[model samples]
Target: MNKSNRRKFIGTAAAVIAVGTAASAMPLSTGKENYPVLHHVFFWLKNPDSKADRDQLVQGVKTLKKIPSIQQLHVGITADTEKRDVVDSSWGVSELLFFKDLAGQAIYQTHPIHLEFIEKYSHLWSKVVVYDIIEA
Candidate 1:
């Protein structure tokens, strides 16, 4: 290879290695005591019939957002993007909730607000998936 080409290749390889090392060494979360973790729950609707079910689920998730224990609540409708193997995007809606701890999450789940939401929108979707992860 030409001298210029060899230099460019070496520089690119070094840059890649540096980025990979930095990413691996980065800390997950700040060193705060009892750092809060985010709980993500997704609902996959088998029936993609009409706007009615989506609207109901949105309203129910909004009610959940109003509860006190929940630090954050986010509802995401699947985007028309490239598919990934991990998520089964055949469903209609995905709900994400964040809490300080398991106790807080449990309260959110069992609270009257959440119960009411379930009663209202439970039948709209056929399947539900939940995922919880704590920051390191």
Candidate 2:
């Protein structure tokens, strides 16, 4: 290798290493927000084949985002993917809610919006399953 070319390569590599070292010494994020409570709800629509029913349920779930205690909300229909024994894609719609703590989730459970949502859209779902998780 030419002397000049080798020197340039070494310089570039040294610069990259120095930058990486500096980055490693610094905190990657300003602050970390933790949500220890996860509320996952799977809804089996009475009319599973009806796109309209699924859409209505998704829209209703989206409204739950208005609840102040919910840190994050995600709503979606079953994914179209390869069949697997562990993956239950039978649900017509699903809602994954994040809460800072159990108290936040408790407030969300009885929130007016939640009660109204159940009253208005409960008929669309024939079966509902909820899994609540708390990180240790």
* Cα-based lDDT at residue 79, candidate 1: 79
Write the residue-wise lDDT of candidate 1 on 23-91 in tens digits. Answer: 999888865545277777778664676677787787788778887888877888877878889756677
Q: Candidate 2 lDDT, tens digit per residue, 87-134?
A: 999889999999999999999999999999999999999999999999
Point to the candidate with the largest lDDT: 2
Using Cα atoms with residue i matched to residue i, what is each candidate's TM-score against the true structure? Answer: 0.68, 0.78
Q: What is the clash count for each candidate, in the order shown?
A: 0, 0
What's the distance in Å from true for residue 71, model 2?
Answer: 0.3
Candidate 2 RMSD computed on C-alpha atoms after optimal superposition onto the true structure: 3.9
